[model samples]
Target: MHEQNPALGLVHVLRAVTVEFDLLGAEFAARHGLHPTDVRALIHLLDATRAGTRATPGWLGEQLRLHSAGTTALIDRLERLGLVRRSRDTADRRRVLLEVEEKATELGWAFFGPVIGEVLAAAEGFEAAELETVRRFLTSVLESVGRARSA
Candidate 1:
């Protein structure tokens, strides 16, 4: 099928990604004691550090594509484990920020090193231009789909 045949091409690519990504998530979760749901939450928190922005539960819920209740529960478990905390935003009493603790932050960073190393090794031959193109494309795709309710 050609790329112009969007439905068939997209379906094939999407299925392949879904299978591989699911396995990656399962393996990471197994090795980390983080369920698939919690792994996504951790990923959300980990990625949010790029902008030095603290996400509220609402923000994280949106980021993780979780409903309010689910986000609340996820945070609840995380907070209980001392991984994440709900802190009132000093600038606004009404704003509650979800903060990943220092220990969780350190541990989470270490946890993802292997995944990054593997991907880097796999991309070793890609030209800088090609790498940038892939980065932009993936970033755009992620931004478009990050809050999606379903795959």
Candidate 2:
């Protein structure tokens, strides 16, 4: 099989890699008493917004492949744990923004640290060129999969 169509043969390998990541994510969510989608939502929020930057439900929904109303509900749950808060955008009177509520990140790190560290360590030996290749491929997959989900 490889002798005939080797170039695209890696698609199956990529799918397997994606499945492993999903399994790890599911385990993390279950251990933390969260839905996998909720944890995924948290990741997207953390990625796009820093300590002081504002993140909105609309923005998060777009990024996380969730509906605006669903993002609001997930946020409501996170808010109960004092994870986040909704804010009115000062410059745009009618807009709402979500900002990291401080304690949430600290708490997340506590439960998530070991697993994340292990995953990072597993990839630590890759050369810079290899790492760059992996990053480029993975980012391309992320965008394609994300676009597919939203579509």
Candidate 3:
């Protein structure tokens, strides 16, 4: 009998997690009358705001692997739904920033709050060191995947 490669096992686990996450995202999108891609773009915009950074349509395009026209259409759709708005950057007048609407934030938290609380509660079971290890591992995985995609 041959032993399975640990790396291969980890890859399988990660793949399963990715699939589950995608399914969850799809469900969330459907509940909000959005496509999965739009939900993901909105999440990215929200995260950027949380990090004190503004997200531009071009940046969102790159993040979502969308072209300029597609990104514009997405922004238009979200803007029409009142989930996001486009504002000119104060410092860079030529730059248009995507801002998630307050109502959208409220809706997101209302919909995802329970799961967020559960995930936070689960994290409390881990020690600080274990959490740090997990964070580092996930970051490394993200880097590796980014490199692979670019390559």
Q: What is the TM-score of each predicted model, taking all chains together?
A: 0.73, 0.74, 0.91
Candidate 1, run of 10 with poorest lDDT: 1-10
For all candidates in order, the CA lDDT equals 0.80, 0.78, 0.91
> What digit string (tens of lDDT, one per residue) describes model 1 on residues 96-136?
98877886767655866777788899899899999998788
- Residues 1-151, candidate 3: write the lDDT tens digits: 8999998988999999889878888988899899998989988998898899779999999999999999999999999999999999999999898899988899888888988899899999999999999899989999999999999
lDDT of 2: 0.78
- Badly placed stretches (over 4 Å) of model 1 are 1-18, 143-151
RMSD of each: 3.8, 3.1, 1.6
Clashes in model 3: which pairs? Answer: none
lDDT of 3 at 138: 88
Q: Tell me the lDDT of candidate 3.
A: 0.91
Residue 146, model 2: Cα distance from true site in angstroms: 3.6
Q: How close is candidate 3 to the true structure, as a TM-score?
A: 0.91
